[model samples]
Target: MTEVGNRHPHGTPCWVSLLARGVEATQEFYGRLFGWEFHPGPSSLGTYVRASLNGKNVAGIGELPRDRPLPIAWTTYFAADDADKTAELVRGCGGTVGVGPLDADDAGRLAIALDPLGAVFGIWQAVHHRGIETSGEPGSPVWNELVTRETSMVATFYSLVFGFETQHVVSTDFDYLTLQLDGRPVGGIHGVGRGLPRDRGAHWMAYFEVADTDAAARQVVQLGGSVLRAPRDSAYGRVATVTDPEGAVFTVIRTEPLPA
Candidate 1:
């Protein structure tokens, strides 16, 4: 298991949070689905709840602001050394800053932005909280992926903003790019294929590691969620896509165990 203590390097997918209509129900759904435990954040932070695995922070959940009701979805946050500078880079690269380089109490400075292709994401400069405390284990985030029609344009935009080394995978079925930080794969970019609905547009999706993809998918259904894609074996492992009761989508994968 990878236990992260220090701040993540720039461009790494450091954190993710779900903005839902009902915080309590969201908490219970994930807790029952992934064996996660939730701890409420400071009251001043509204209804934010940190989801943990084995006592380590894995993700966060909060109610959608009443004034600015957004579609229930998980937002992927990439690490940045300077939130303001990253926001500026986003704008300069034809992206739009949707939120702020605003302070989140003493936790960090954060800003939400849209990529040129319209995928919304967050940038975080950590202070008191250093993003997810544990990763690459069941119940923790394992990967973040961007799906877009503008594969080359999106690739160039992220590479310019985050200094990521893009590695394109050769495949006739689909176009895929791996974003690397210091030569280590951190995230991926997938070209939206014809098989997907045209109205789907561009978006960032988070994937969580699971011990059993079929079992997790079943739990999701039992907890009022729906499985968009049934569990299927892939080159990577067994994978499934599911949506919470509020319709926030995420992927789960049962990866092959590493050689001892």
Candidate 2:
């Protein structure tokens, strides 16, 4: 969460959205999985809905452009005070701005871009909407991470673009950097080198909090989705990677221990 009423600071992971092949079908899948309620969003971006959990906005789902035919994937958006300025920074830093720094009515200004490594992400300048209303709670986003080939190089790109300070999380052999804004951890970057998914390239991954990781993974399969990775414990929590019916990948994690 970006403190509800308060605007998120620049460089923080402010929102995550999925542009799927079918809007209603995507809504049905996510609603059943995360118990999210859908509400109409800015129509300027085509069929779009904001997903809310218990009345607080958590994410967005929009219909993919028929003409462009983009991949069915979730994109993590970072907060920007000025969307156009951010787009300039992206281009100056060797990234590509594939979409607009244009207004989506009164909601906000946005631009979709790709990092130098071709990792897709977004920049959001909020107006009426303040990004996610709740986070770190069940059914809400808990973390966002960039998985790419080299953390050092891409870390510098984000640092220059977002003024992010990178904090190394692991040894040189295992490359990981926790992105910080104002000395607080906002997101992370992981370098997997040759292990990068050839089809996906570099991309930001969104993690949603769930009450039970194993149960959630099973529920995903039950709801016509697939578990890409089985539930497993990690340093942060028990997590599993899963994809929606349309193959948009995301992770669900049990951030707290279950009752005995």
Candidate 3:
């Protein structure tokens, strides 16, 4: 397990959040799936709670905004030194800021935005809350990736906006690039070409760590959620795609255990 301290470097995938339709039900679904515990969060964003694992914050869940009515999905947040400046950079880089660089009740400054290819992501200038506190272990976030049709274009967008350094992943058939900060990979972009989902479009995907991929996928179904993709072994781990009861999609992976 990895424990995160306050102040992540800019461009890191620092936090993730799910805005679902039902607050209590969403909490129960995730809590049961990942063994998470919930605690209250800033009220300015409506009913929200921080999900914790063994006393460390791992993610957040908020009730869907009544006025906005967006599709239930997980949003990956990148850390920023200055949210206002980052929002301007997003606008300057052919992206659109759909939400705020405004304060989230002193927890942080946040903004939701779309990339040139319409992939949704978030920027956070943390205050008292310093994003996720633990990761790289079962029940915590392990990766965040963007699936898009224009990998090169979106890579340039994020590189310019977030100061992320891009390295093309060498593959025969896959168009993939890893976004790096200080030579460490923070996230990735996968070029799906015309294979992008029509209804979903381009979006960020968050993957959580699990102890067992097949068991987690089964539990997702048992908890009223569904598995979009069956568990499969990959170079990184055994992984499965799943959705919550309210249709929020995420992946679960059981990577080879960390070395002692």
Best by lDDT: 2
lDDT of 1: 0.88
Worst 10 residues of 1 by lDDT: 192-201
* Pairs of residues clashing in candidate 3: none
TM-score of 1: 0.94
Q: State the lDDT at 132 in candidate 1.
A: 92
lDDT of 3 by residue, 211-240 (tens): 999999999999999999999998789999
Task: Return the lDDT, model 3, position 140.
Answer: 100
After superposing candidate 1, which stretches have Cα over 4 Å from the reference? 1-5, 42-45, 193-199, 258-260
lDDT tens per residue, model 2, 40-61:
9998988999999989999999
Candidate 2 Cα deviation (angstroms), residue 118: 0.2
Q: How many residue pairs clash in all the candidates, one count each? A: 0, 0, 0
TM-score of model 2 vs. true structure: 0.95
